[model samples]
Target: MDWIVITVLFFILGLSAILIIGTLVSLPQVGDERKNLIKMKAQSYTFAVAMGYVLIQLFKNIYNGSNEGINPFTFLITISIIYLISLLFFRKKYGS
Candidate 1:
């Protein structure tokens, strides 16, 4: 990967981490109903972002004719990171 792409990816990941941490920190102060609503919205947003990222990668691969299949490790890591982040948010909000 190019240096610019890597840099941008890191920037995005950092922003994501900040957002997740901020949400987690604030979740406890909210009421239960509001917290559940926020959790649902957060999960939907995370899913959308992850799907968009994967689709972008797929398109790039098609354009570049890189037959090297998607790395399972990277795919799993991306998904698991998103899952864990949302899980943290849910746990903090709902005590689950």
Candidate 2:
């Protein structure tokens, strides 16, 4: 695989990590039906966003040059940016 594809994969994985972490951190402490529903919604949204990021990156890799062996920190920063953008756009739509 090209470096660009590798970089995009890194970003997608990082985004997925962020989503899972976010859901874990935000989950309510209480246990009940309401909490269960809330947790499911959070998980669903996180999964959806993560998948979207991966799909988007797959397309981007087609035209971009390979970006092999890029720094993790750089990949993380880009992941954060994409996560924030998705949050901003989806927050209202999902009413989270």
Candidate 2, backbone clash total:
5
Best prediction by TM-score = 1
Residue ranges of candidate 1 with Cα displaced over 4 Å? 1-32, 83-96
Stretches off by above 4 angstroms in model 2 are 1-31, 65-96
Tens-digit lDDT string for candidate 2 (1-96): 588877877777777677756754654555555445654554466567667766666666655855434456555565555555555444334434
Q: Could you tell me which residue pairs clash in candidate 1?
A: none
User: Per-prediction TM-score, please?
Assistant: 0.47, 0.40
- Candidate 2 positional error at 11, Å: 19
- Ten contiguous residues minimizing lDDT sum, candidate 2: 87-96
Q: In model 2, what is the error at residue 60, expressed in angstroms?
A: 0.2
TM-score of 2: 0.40
Clashes of each: 0, 5
In Å, residue 86's CA in model 1 sits off its true spot by: 5.7
Score candidate 2 by lDDT. Answer: 0.58
